[model samples]
Target: MKISPKARMNRLFTNGGCLDVAIDHGVCNEPSFMVGLEDMPRVVDSLIRAKPDAIQMAYGQADLLQSRPEKDKPALVMRLDMGNPYNATRHRTMWSMLQNADEPIIGALEMDAACVVVNLFMLPDEPEMFRQCVENISRVRADCHRYGMPLMIEPLVMLSNEIRGGYQVDGDADKIVTLVRLAAEMGADIIKADPTANPEDFHRVVEAARVPVLVRGGGKEDLKTVLMKSAALMAHGAKGMVYGRNIYQHANPGAVVRALMSMIHDGADGEAAWQVYNRG
Candidate 1:
């Protein structure tokens, strides 16, 4: 156990306000990642000004980040495991494609990251694969904990055709709770999962989970809709938000991120957050 759970939680909490930009898709799926890289400098500059509590990047990007001064940077978390977008398979299996424990540990040591995140999601045709992923992440979490590094586990519910590119698993609250429980039991220090579209149901998952919960953002929608949902999650006791294209792919990512920060860390209402974006 950590010497002080309260201190540890405080260090990890970001005051119940966090903005985690998911730039890990490059290594996991997107081959034209240089396109993402093209926009990264601007996106990162915007996010830093927005003052997110943390920013997530692929292990590969850590090298680039290392060259920058730490004074102006958001806290970092390196992603350890990944799968291809073309695979068309939910990440349920343990394959050599995923990073080994030593890799992230070494990266954490080198990058001076605040934590590491791994995923564990269930697929319709792969119960056995899910089991293997669970076991694999469990071992990784234990190793992370032993070294006093925080580990966040994301449990996805697999989406439907309506939102073809959705990265989050699209399931109900009860189902999400089960996945969160499994990850926490596996020794994850923090759990990131989907927020129920309904606030009441989303709160229920927050109450039941053993670890801190940061809602993962997916589902393509307008910027206002995204900000509203993210606000709702925070109001219902989510520790924070981890989102990708929702921020990076926006027409005005800087403004969008500023709006998100108002709701998250500044306690602004959705309307107030919108105002901030419009002002920008």
Candidate 2:
């Protein structure tokens, strides 16, 4: 029995919002990302206990989470591409589709994924890289429609300079809004975008996307700051967040996830969420 994309999408959200934990960073081949993830099985087990709305992972690691026998588990979101923009030492701009790029939908279905995620990057002075990203989205979009699989597009504006030792997120409002709109135009069912530099300016991104926008948690931040930003982004019309380092690298990953869930789903303010984080 095949499931409709709408049905699968519904599983990825609760109360009209989602709190997706991204454990797909290892695919970027960055050693720093492997700090907490050294024990993949343990990480997956802890995350399953945390019970986020969805778990985004690469195809190879999808089984670690999805293979569990738990009746209630996070929906799987398979990442369908890899890129080298995250290499901190050398700033090389390259993006490539995964092994199953040609038939990504089939691979995702085989893994029982509810959604598929791909990148649509806008980098400075990299026209060819930008072109590759666009073509990747176009190809994935067509297959998504054919197979009724939800597609989540991560549209990022990056500066490739050695800012803070690695490629930095360009939070310029105008640039983010432009690429976000383009992602929606290219048929993204859901858009995961970086928040603008100004929290208030994030509303413009939400408006331009014209689709469900999930704010991306770029880097790790302190507990209070992460909670406050989550509340602010939700107030700015964001549907939810797709967080990685902030959740996975914390002293207690499950605690942070629950705190975020409270803010996103229960309308808990920053202070209240902080209490939850400290409780764990």
Best by the TM-score measure: 2
lDDT of 2 by residue, 142-258 (tens): 888888899999998987665655557998999999999999899888999998888889999999988789999987888799889788888899988999999999999999999
Error of 2 at 182 (Å): 0.3
Clashing residue pairs in candidate 1, if any? 92-129, 157-169, 158-169
TM-score of model 2 vs. true structure: 0.96
Candidate 1 per-residue lDDT, tens place, 171-269, comes to 577778878877777877777888775766777777667667888876446888877777787778887788777777667767777788778778988
Model 1 regions lying over 4 Å from their true place: 1-12, 31-39, 85-97, 101-104, 160-168
lDDT (0 to 1) per candidate: 0.69, 0.87
TM-score of each: 0.86, 0.96
lDDT of 2 at 191: 96
